[model samples]
Target: MFVWHGRLYVVRQVLNSWSERVPWWRSTVQPDPPVGAVPERGDHRVWRVEASPGRALGTATYDLACVPPPPLAGHLRPTWTLIRVAD
Candidate 1:
C-alpha cells in the first residue's frame, strides 16, 4: 500500500520495476551525499504498477520509487514516492 495526496492506494499488479543510478555529477539541484551514503541522492528503485484507491474499481498506472533513506534520530525511515499517475 502507498499513500498519495492523503489517499491510500493498493498495488494491484506490478507492470515493471528497475533500478536507476543518477550521475550526481550531472545534477544541478544539489551535491551528492557523503561517501558510503545510501541512495546517493539519485539512485533509486522504480516500479510501475496498477493501483487504485481503497479497492475502487477505477485503476491507474502508478510509477513508484523506493530508496534507502538516511538515518533519522539514529533510525531509518524508508519511504515511497509516487512518481507518475495515468488513469
Candidate 2:
C-alpha cells in the first residue's frame, strides 16, 4: 500500500524489479565498515508496480525504490521510496 497526494493506493501487481549498485567512487562520503562486518554492496532496488487508487479511481503504473540499510546495519529493514508515476 502507498499514499500519494492525499489518496491511498494499493499495489495490484509488480511488473518488474531490479537492483542498482551505488557508485561509491562518485560519492564524497566513503562507506565505513564496522569491525568484523562486511560492507553492503547494493544501493537501491527499483520496482515497477501497478497500483489502484480505488473503485472510483483507475489504475496506474508507478516506479518505486527500496533503499537498503547502511553498511553497518545489516539487520535493519529497507525503506520504500516513490520514484515516479506513469501516465
Candidate 3:
C-alpha cells in the first residue's frame, strides 16, 4: 500500500491478487524469545486493492506490483508496461 497525504491506497491489480509471505526462520529453529511472536511460517498477506480500468486513455487494466509504490498525494501513476486491457 502507498501512503498519500498519510492515507493508505492500494493498487487494484495487487489488491485483486494480494498476497503475503510469513517468516521462515522460526520454523527452521526455536522461536526467538526476544521478539516473542510465533512466526507463522508461509502465512501470506491479503491485499485489498482498488483499480479503475480505463481511468486514462489507452489504459485498460493496470498491473500492480511490489515496486515503485504510489506517489504520496502527488499523482496516481500507473506502470506503463504493467498497464493492460482485458481481451
Top-TM-score candidate index:
1
Summarize candidate 1's per-residue lDDT along 1-87 as a digit string, tens digits: 888889888888999999887665667666665776554446789899999887546888999878777655257655577777888
How many pairs collide in each candidate, listed in order?
0, 0, 4
Q: TM-scores of all models?
A: 0.69, 0.68, 0.23
- Residue 1 in candidate 1, Cα distance off native in Å: 0.5
The digit string of per-residue lDDT tens for model 2 on 1-87 reads: 988888889998999999877676745477576775445455789999999989677889998988877766768777777888996
**Model with the higher TM-score, candidate 1 or 2:** 1
Candidate order by lDDT, decreasing, is 2, 1, 3
Candidate 1 Cα misplacement greater than 4 A, ranges: 23-26, 31-40, 70-74
Per-residue accuracy of model 3 over 15-73 as CA lDDT, tens digit each: 36554453466557864435532223354434334544334523223443332223452
True lDDT of residue 72, candidate 3 = 53
Off by over 4 Å in 2: 22-42
- Candidate 2's TM-score reads 0.68
Model 1 lowest lDDT segment of ten: 70-79
Clashes of 1: 0
